[model samples]
Target: MCEWVNRIEYSLWTQHCDEGRRFGHMTKNISECMNSILKGVRNFPVCSLVKATYGRDNSEFTVAETTLTDSFSLGSYRVSLASQTCDCGYFQALHFPCPHALACCAYSWLTWEPYVHQLYRLNSVFSVYRMGFTPPISEGFWPPYDGPTVIPVPNKRRAREGRPTSTRIRTNMDEADPNRPKRCGLCRQPGHTRRSCPQLRGAEHTRGHD
Candidate 1:
């Protein structure tokens, strides 16, 4: 029986199953592929892992011309990969590649490292720490000050403190402009307010009888 089953083709075994093609099965699991990619990275420190991932040159570069559009605003920005500039000004101002420039780099299959400022690079950060700082001298060895000592005025000191009262002097500028005309709120006419308006008085008098 085993020898006869071995003689039959594998396709003959699955001929009765109608839904076999719809299963979308893969020969290799996705997690296994990811584990293979991150094989040695598991033991790496966070910073080293990030650096390794960023510096990895496994991706193949492709030649393609493409345009990037801002989805939210539906705006087109000109990005110059060679000059490391975008029309939005963020790339130049921040010394980092902006979204538009990053999109351009991705579309062109180019590396964005060249566009980034050296100040942000790991080498620059390492260089900063390479310099040895001079040890600070003891405070007792500091030079004495010859300048006059400042004394606080007793009158200026707060007498009572909850929230300190504002000491801002009221000036003419703080008041509303006198040249501007006041309007009557009830009639929408200049000179009198709604409280003293004749129309308001008439309305009150008419409503009193009803």
Candidate 2:
């Protein structure tokens, strides 16, 4: 299931999720995990993201039973043990084996560490950053300027030929931002949204009257 705010957010910050499961320990675990990750890598890239930022808590491996399956369910998790995925989306999203997957590993008597993506492993991350970066020399130390300058291109700067639709890409962060004064789609007026637009109401009113 999708959780809007974490348990720590509700219990420590605000009481939003009374019905939700309590994971008070995660506050410390998450903090320490992020701390270790930051200590490992400060930069981000598509390929290195999972490896530079993977750490499973000690809490995950403490599974109770010895049972393996293509599917496993307990509380919030709906894990597809075969595909190595969870309904929480953390597993596939990070390309690292999530807590749910690790739990399955424990039950199956399989080693938990191997289930995680190699990129997220400590040894892999440490190996890359171990090499020191060579310092770049100043422009004065550079070779003589020999290349021809190629720079006349106003035609190349023109916008692509297409009807430009006024739409912005929606991101997950947008959900947390405060609602803005929406513009009406019908009459193109500010202050009211498309749903509550007076122009739409007026049109409907006139149609009903007719």
Candidate 3:
């Protein structure tokens, strides 16, 4: 029965599965393979892991963010640095610049593209499951499996009983100011005519003043 199971497993692996082929549509399997590569790295020191992961040879150099021009083929939308995203789903979901944005940045000679991982990648998620494993203990440790002297923490300072006075400071106002009149929606300036606003109407003298 064990031999039969082994044969079956081998056969399954050798045979092509439709779903497995479909999984490669957007490189989903590649991400899963990367996750497996990172599995053993969880127990290692973080600085060491970073140095290893983003090492000179292994690093995937990316392009920088820059203004989109008619000359560049950026598809439908532009790269918005303020939002840290491109119009396509790439930068918004990943918090990393999309290929177009990266290309723009590279062309512009910007280096911010290298640090995008700090903004988006969740390193803590990998630590959670990796920390669950216990290290192998030395023999002759006995049933307690202990070595170091555990000390009861000494209280250095007494805990404060009362809350700070700043916490009790209260204000009478229940809502924001209501008298603040809406600014000219056109120019976004206060006390201005909407149609006459220079921004929306474009800068010009009234009727005939050159």
Candidate 4:
């Protein structure tokens, strides 16, 4: 067991050390992260909030000169406002400005809205529901069916059994290895299960002996 455990790093086993360094929080979950991102916008209307939040200042971030005009340096990270990307990788993956990108936006006196994907915008969402779907026609006005009807064979019908079997598609995961030994539940021994265990049968027969 110790040899098996030694094969993997200790950071993977416990989240204590890695969680703080990676996410800046020891116990932060998805819900908390979302709440932090949309903090003040909850009280306002969706469209109004989007506009209002975009106009808000990010004056906390201090501007610093980098090698390139479009890029900004944040310690180990490189944020490019023109390309809409950051060295941390969250900008491209989440289709929005990451911490580094947002910092660069603040430094450049630019709004973060342009860096966000169109799919998340209120106008794109409103456009989707603009076209009204026509209501489905009633079954009474349907055309008559001239095609041959399907008929089930009487012999093909399944007979009543103790329990109805599942019709779900089977996969490779369902197959058990033939080499594995079956163990007895009561005795914790191999070869037979608890139902056919000799010790259990003897115990049942000698119930009044004690």
Write down the TM-score for model 2: 0.30
Off by over 4 Å in 4: 1-68, 139-210
Residue pairs in steric clash, candidate 4? none
Which whole-number lDDT from 0 to 100 does residue 75 have in model 1? Answer: 56
- TM-score against truth, every candidate: 0.35, 0.30, 0.25, 0.35
Those runs of model 1 whose alpha carbons end farther than 4 Å from true positions after fitting are 1-75, 139-150, 153-210
Give the candidate order by descending lDDT. Answer: 4, 1, 2, 3
Structural RMSD, model 1: 24.2
- Model 1 over residues 126-190: C-alpha lDDT tens digits? 99889999999999999997999989998788867598867899998889987989998779999
lDDT of 2 by residue, 17-106 (tens): 434333333443566756665664557674565665443332343342333345777578888766768998988888777877877766
Q: Supply every candidate's count of residue pairs whose N, Cα or C atoms clash at under 3 angstroms.
A: 0, 2, 2, 0
Write one digit per residue (lDDT tens) for candidate 4, span 1-210.
Answer: 999987888666556647545434444476775466568777778996676545442322223233246777788998887777888999988999998888777766778898899999999999999999999899999989899998989767776876656788999999998998989989999989999999998998899686
- Over 1-210, each residue of candidate 3 has an lDDT whose tens digit, in order, gives 778777664424433554444432344456775555566675789886676567532433322112333233456767655566677778778767778777766665666555376634466566566766777887777476467887756554444787533535557774567797767877688877787677754455444355
Top candidate on TM-score is 1
Which ranges of candidate 2 are over 4 A from the true structure?
1-68, 127-134, 138-210
Candidate topping lDDT: 4
Worst 10 residues of 4 by lDDT: 58-67
Winner by lDDT between candidate 3 and candidate 1: 1
Q: After TM-score superposition, what is the CA distance of residue 28 in candidate 1 from its true location, in Å?
A: 31
